[model samples]
Target: MPDESATLALGAALWPQLPVTGCVYLSGDLGAGKTTLVRGLLRAAGHDGAVRSPTYTLIEPYELVGRQVFHLDLYRLGDPEELEFIGLRELLGQGLLLVEWPAQGRGVLPAPDWTIDLAADGQGRQATLAIQ
Candidate 1:
């Protein structure tokens, strides 16, 4: 994608292709458009509220008309075990999960069904998707 808009468009296109219930890991550095893409997904899924990174909150839950989506940013996680306190297992069984900085969750997080990696490419960005 050449910019955030393009990245968001890609995310909108990818929303319907996503499984009803599964995990997606988003890998990218700060300002890499990870949250922008996630915002795209949420908007496509009928979310009209502001979409913000859960960097400090750790997780944000969105309950749409027909589905539930959880966006997690584990960047500041002190330890993977912290996930246990957040009902991670229960959420995995109920809705779609979009995890950013997934490595921070490591052993505590479930295996993702898809992994999307983003990076800076000049003034634009590059995205790679892997299905597991």
Candidate 2:
């Protein structure tokens, strides 16, 4: 596992090398810095806007360096059925997706191309990243 900033930077650096058509699922507990990682990614991608969790809205879209980036927080989702109502299918195919609390969506969501798991370790964190 890597440190928080390193993990976020690694993820950002790897962004350009990714498939260019898949999602990245972030599985971890609350306060895990998932959004922080995403903020780093967006900043690396040349975005300067405030990066906030999409907890209440479910998803937030950003246009960065000519690419679309989607950050999703599924913590409030009660069921997978709600995905269709939010037009998930349409937004997914065209952007880089960074999802938090992915277990909440389960079957309704697509298989992730990569997975990032963050856990607290004392004052810092342990981040495990898997690319499949």
Candidate 3:
């Protein structure tokens, strides 16, 4: 998109079409706006509070708009096996799962239903979505 607002709008537009239960892997380098996109998606789902990256915690769970949503940032993960320690297995299929740095959790994380890859493009970002 052309700007952060555009990126957020793309996410807002996606809210209705997104399945309530599925995995979405967000791929991108640092400062690529992955969390910003997720923030927009959640806002469309009626979340009025802050939407911050769960970089340190690894997972941020949101019980919103009548469903569960979990955002995970695995950049700090030392190993894929660490996901099990965070109860990822139990969270699977329970709600919408948005994962960042999924490459870090390759073996432990389930295959995503959707993948969003973001990259810098001029002053904005280029986001590509893939269904798998």
TM-scores of all candidate predictions against the true structure? 0.97, 0.89, 0.97
Error of 3 at 112 (Å): 0.7
Q: Tell me which of candidates 1 and 2 scores higher on lDDT.
A: 1
Task: Give every collision pair in model 3.
Answer: none
lDDT against the true structure, each candidate: 0.93, 0.83, 0.93
List, residue by residue over 1-132, the lDDT tens digit for candidate 1: 887789889889999998878999999989999999999998888899999999999999999888899999999999999999988988977989999999999998989999999999876999999999
Which parts of model 1 have CA positions greater than 4 angstroms off?
Answer: none
Q: Return the TM-score for candidate 2, rounded to 2 decimals.
A: 0.89
RMSD of 2: 2.0
Model 2: CA > 4 A from native: 1-11
Output the lDDT of residue 119, model 1: 96
Tens-digit per-residue lDDT, 18-116, candidate 3? 889999999999989999999989999999999999999999999996799999999999999999999999999899999999999998898998999
Better of 2 and 3 by lDDT: 3
Clashes of each: 0, 0, 0
TM-score of candidate 1 versus the correct structure, residues matched by position: 0.97
Error of 2 at 132 (Å): 0.8
RMSD, one per candidate, in order = 0.8, 2.0, 0.8
